[model samples]
Target: MPFTPFHMGAGLAAKALAGRHFSVLTFGIAQLAMDIEPLVGMLRDAPVLHGPTHTYLGAVPIACVTAALAPWLCRPLLRRWNQEVRHYRMPWLQESERWSPQVVLASALAGTFSHVLLDSVMHLDIRPWAPWSDTNGLYATISLSALHLLCMAGMAGGALGWVALQWLRSRRAAQRQRHNP
Candidate 1:
């Protein structure tokens, strides 16, 4: 599913579960990186659409590049969103929170690897191991409905978890302010 939101659902879950350890922006960049090969192939009508970029061998380097460059592009957007998400923002993070290198690397790797896994399930042409072997036994192992449901579940669960965490933080802040003020 190139350019689809299905990939984002996993990214959202990563952000919710990993919190500061994961960068959603970097994850998105990695997801786009994973699909770039196929997107170009489709545009040019190339014979091999999935290509090497969909393989594990390709994901490592792509993830690294995304990790290195994505933060620079995403930091500004994150800062803007951070400012807007007042309810979710930590008092100490007011205009100071930025995506660290560690967070960017981790999230990019997670996103690229997950993209390979998700695509491997649906695309018969995706040889995740590639060069070593050209077999894809994982193709259509599960129904499309099941895969879509899993993505949707991730989105719902991630949203709930994020909201809950923010609410708890806000509540704690309120309690502290009451006692201190």
Candidate 2:
């Protein structure tokens, strides 16, 4: 999709928040969240599971458990980021208000699940249905060359189509609400 990084992140984060507030967004949120992890692949640089954990088998447990634990991860993981180059800083909230566990978890879980699913569609090597078997249940082959460009192309096309459909539906819904109201 042509969505900016912020929009994508916000979309998936919203999905995480949706678990506690299920409505029209449940599916969209899931899609957004699943899409997030695949895009942000800092791990891709490392010699990790076929380009930053794109394996379907790897994404599922991560999705479900992460979704289940989303509430926990979102509640201000107060830790110190002590870089040798920079001064040590602790991550804390600006306000004194405490976060709700359920809400926090919901945000994280949705984002995680969405990330896994989207990654699977994006990469054929990702075995979304793995752990059940030794082989990766990837939808696409992992040749990592121009020969397999079609695989990624298809995934990108699907995402674009999905985004277009969603935008159209939202526009129609807004029109309906505006006219009817």
The global C-alpha lDDT for each of the candidates, from Candidate 1 onward, is 0.83, 0.41
| TM-score top scorer | 1
lDDT of 1 at 167: 67
lDDT of 2 by residue, 77-137 (tens): 3222113112423211111123454544454444445444444444444554545543444
TM-score per model over all chains: 0.88, 0.34
lDDT of 1 by residue, 16-48 (tens): 787777777789899998898999999998888
In model 1, the runs with Cα more than 4 Å from the true position are 87-96, 177-181
Clashes in model 1: which pairs?
Answer: none
